[model samples]
Target chain A: MFDINKRPEVIQLSHGGGGKEMNKLIKSLFFSAFNNPILNNDEDAARLHLNGDIAFTTDSFTVSPLFFAGGDIGKLAIAGTVNDLAMMGAKPEYLSCSFIIEEGFEVGKLKKVVDSMVNEMDKSGAKIVCGDTKVVPKGCADGLLINTSGIGRIQFDGVSVTNIKLGDVIIVSRDIGRHGAAILMERESLALETTLTSDCATLWPTVKHLIEAKLEIHAMRDATRGGVSAVLNEWAMGSNVGITVKESAIPVCDEVKGMCELYGFEPFDLANEGTFLIALPEDEAIKALDIMHEFGCEATAAIIGRVSEDRPGKVILKTPWGSRRYLDLPQGELLPRIC
Target chain B: MFDINKRPEVIQLSHGGGGKEMNKLIKSLFFSAFNNPILNNDEDAARLHLNGDIAFTTDSFTVSPLFFAGGDIGKLAIAGTVNDLAMMGAKPEYLSCSFIIEEGFEVGKLKKVVDSMVNEMDKSGAKIVCGDTKVVPKGCADGLLINTSGIGRIQFDGVSVTNIKLGDVIIVSRDIGRHGAAILMERESLALETTLTSDCATLWPTVKHLIEAKLEIHAMRDATRGGVSAVLNEWAMGSNVGITVKESAIPVCDEVKGMCELYGFEPFDLANEGTFLIALPEDEAIKALDIMHEFGCEATAAIIGRVSEDRPGKVILKTPWGSRRYLDLPQGELLPRIC
Candidate 1:
């Protein structure tokens, strides 16, 4: 392990000056954790000989309370980008990470963040090939903001929001609103002795299984920020089809349910990081669920909704009490920086 | 133009919440500025068909005094990442932009920044394909920070920092330290009444000419952050070769020279965003200079250095008045956020 012995306990502006200090930090921490031939080449940019169709995405993670129940900013940074590629039927490959760290942030804390990122990358088999770091003066930034951009090679095609068919069934990978609930719990210090960890995880493994199962997935998106409400509404508008979902079929844990009720917020409007919804033909929905179940994220794999031709460009939700209402896109901020 | 009249002048948290307001802001501002087919797909990730050797680079711009004399953070963010690919002899192609803006920032100012980005991308003919936006509460971030990750195709090879050959002539593309000096002037509100603009620019046009000219280009790098001094030191150490340069041959305009004198700084150690250095065979140096002059960025291109076999892993500088010394990498903080 490399020690921050000679250096001050806090980062200085020189460390981001593209000089000897910055070089040392990169080699010792970044290169050490993400050790690979392509990254160690020391060129101005990473040289990748990619072929065929590729998927590219970028995300900036600014989750407050950097450390949370089940993950940290670093873990979310890696998973958020990997999931974006997976949803496009792409095999996650290379990622570029850039950090804007506030001056006076503890070196020990930075090490922990890097370690968390390395551990998360292992789960998805993605390598951080290139990175940049900049340090700002005290009070300039809250703590740190991480940006991750990823590249992946497409393994299959025909997955898009506009590809939804009228008879397609929507299958959710796992329980919803756990990530948002967990963040709220941490922010309020709600230590109710509940193991309510955030559902912040890498979704490529589960997504790969569905792909291998040969299910003709029409659309897939993680219910992030605006939660399932946003995804369902966007799909309806883009595909010009109506969506009907059952409130009872949507999975929500007791802890999350309690939090939602206490805060007077709808579960569908809360954000999720790990949970994803897939739209496929009704005949293939069972096979997708079976593959998702075997992957063992949880028993929450379920078919909760289906596409309809009745009302185009709208999502209707049927409650257990036999009442129906429009599932509108969340209008304003539900939870900021929940990713 | 999409008006901010229907919206609040100050950005709110709702604009980054992945909801209706966020969607409206994206389509109205970002989508309009970076309009392209791939970006209009409205998918989780952009699909691209690429082949052969590709260069990938990432950079986060947090330049203080967002607007400087010659450029703003938006322009710097685009040029900085594009130059990284050009240094590897790649043709700039696709870029992913992610923005982290603080709440309460003026929407008008944000539009100006996005407009600047569009102008900079025009120079390199690169398209913005995918993006993510997040907003932090007021005081959580200092205005806004942008992270741009780019992918380009390498047209030529052997442009590694470790590929410098013995007896190669080192050419400075233009006068150095203008970028760092310009930023300092902006930060301090220096009313020097001088036209000292930053050297920040896209280098693909100049690099394309070099590749077309078919010079035996061994190495090329933009002198950013630690400026030319840092680049030379790294090359000497990485290639295990000695480099000797004449102090008087390095071009420094009167404005930059005056700033260096007033601040007790070394021009070689200051940053240069657009200026670059080339290492090629001595016989091909003049041809490279002629091509650079015709490009018309400036006529300050000159051969200020040479690679030698003596004193491996070191850079030696000879002064005009008959003094010599080792030009080591800049140690302490020279300037922060000068890119």
Candidate 2:
């Protein structure tokens, strides 16, 4: 039923049936893109050979517009899961990809999304070992939503929010808020001449490098939804320590700043994808920053803050003008589906 | 921001913002239902200590009319993933649940779904250790979709589709096609004064019994979408063998048979949730049937077929009247969102 030349331009309900058409579509598209012996086995579940401690995580990507400046939903799906593993100081291994596709969605578009997923997966060296596809009736769903659950081998121990200690330095991996700004711009149909794009990329490559270097990492987290403000606040509260962030060192590109100004949003309240925060000893901060620079994060990665014992469970942001304010955790909704 | 006295009747975008409101929703709802020390740790990813061969699988449930007969989407989501692990001869252990919910959805309904999930998970003893929740703007999604990814420890080996050898006995654990019929009746608003419900129950309890008994399980599969026909065809093709099913031996209740007849559907092509098929050696067929009987499948469980060497890669059905015909795989879409 899924003849290469005679396939439906738009997906039909039958394509999701656990029958011949579904088999053909899976074998021709998903299987080919995520080709692997474990996946090719075609069993009810994928058999995995795992040892030691493992990290388990799950996320569902329902980003609106599907296609964004630097990546599509598919790309976001893979990077998002892989990044979680990276933040846990784990080497991302097997991933399960599931998609809930809306009826009438174009097969061509689906192919493009799957391709983006494959390309993004290559950056993290993780393979999608098993997947499930379900098609909903028209008007029952909007476009497609992807869910990716990851299993990774823990490469190092003691990387946790609770591990942040006094004198531990906090580093912002790169410029923040691009993912949020890019999505807002695309939604508003801004035709600016500037080449702005979402900072969405797989972070495992850099995390792997840092792990191999053994720089004594305490905690790491991507500045995703609710941005750095949320991550900093949680660390301070969870670790029972205070954080002092030098406002000037927190990178915010001109594009993001402009969007924030135009939209009455704070840069700290924006979301990010590729950017991350690292917490380690003060002496190792320099080493971590150097490694980040070597990974092409130069001029962006900076020692932004430090952990303090004073005023536990608080985050203070010192402004460039010599003033300070409590960087409270984000409240209410800034933007939905900005991931 | 989350005042216990001022909770909104419906979910707001702030609930998924990764901030105070999101934290409150997670703590008040999800955390309380799937309460466990590992989940309460609140790390970016759940740290799990896993060893030996494991089974990893993922599924996204987008069943239309989130509440169905006998089970809601939440129960289905948990049972579906746990069943996949059970089929793989694995012990259901940990799961990561992610929700893509539409904005303005009822908070009360969400609680109901979550409660149903907890109840169903109790049957499998799998703990949900981590989860992600995303709220999409109204109209961007339909109701809610759940993605559950699971990791389980494999207990036995040699359980595969390709392992179905000649002289294997095929057995159906229970009456088939109830799930598909229930969904269809609901969609069509048929007031058939009959007690027809979706066969959506946690199958791990029954599967666990079989595994513990150590009866050779060549291959086992739950008859979900595309029904038993799909499973049979896949087994035939994958094992490079022939299967002959006796039409009279497959169990079907009176109500289900009536609904299928009215809808002009073949019961074998309809979906099921809790029902499953097992392929074992002919010598162990009686033992397997007895185990199923002890597990409360006595009236429904039946040895419906046998694997054969003739007509490799195909399935034949012997009718009650002694006629025989090829039981081809279900083709095209039988019913969208059957599961």
Q: Which has the greatest lDDT?
A: 1
- The CAPRI quality class of candidate 2 comes to high
What's model 1's lDDT at A232?
Answer: 96
Q: List A-chain TM-scores for all predictions.
A: 0.96, 0.96
Which residue pairs collide in model 2, if any? A14-B333
True contacts kept of each: 0.89, 0.93
All DockQ scores: 0.84, 0.84
lDDT of 1 by residue, A1-339 (tens): 887676658788888988888888789878998899988998889999999999999999999889999999999999999999999989899999998888888888889999999999998899999989898888888888899999999988979999999899998888899989999999888878899989998999988888888888999999898999999999999999999999999999999999999888898998888989999999998888888888846898899998999699999999999999999999876777776
True contacts kept of 2: 0.93
In angstroms, give how far residue A186 of model 1 lies from its true place.
1.0
Q: Can you give the TM-score per candidate against the true fold?
A: 0.97, 0.97
Give the CA lDDT, 0 to 100, for residue B283 in model 2. Answer: 93
TM-scores for chain B, in order?
0.97, 0.96
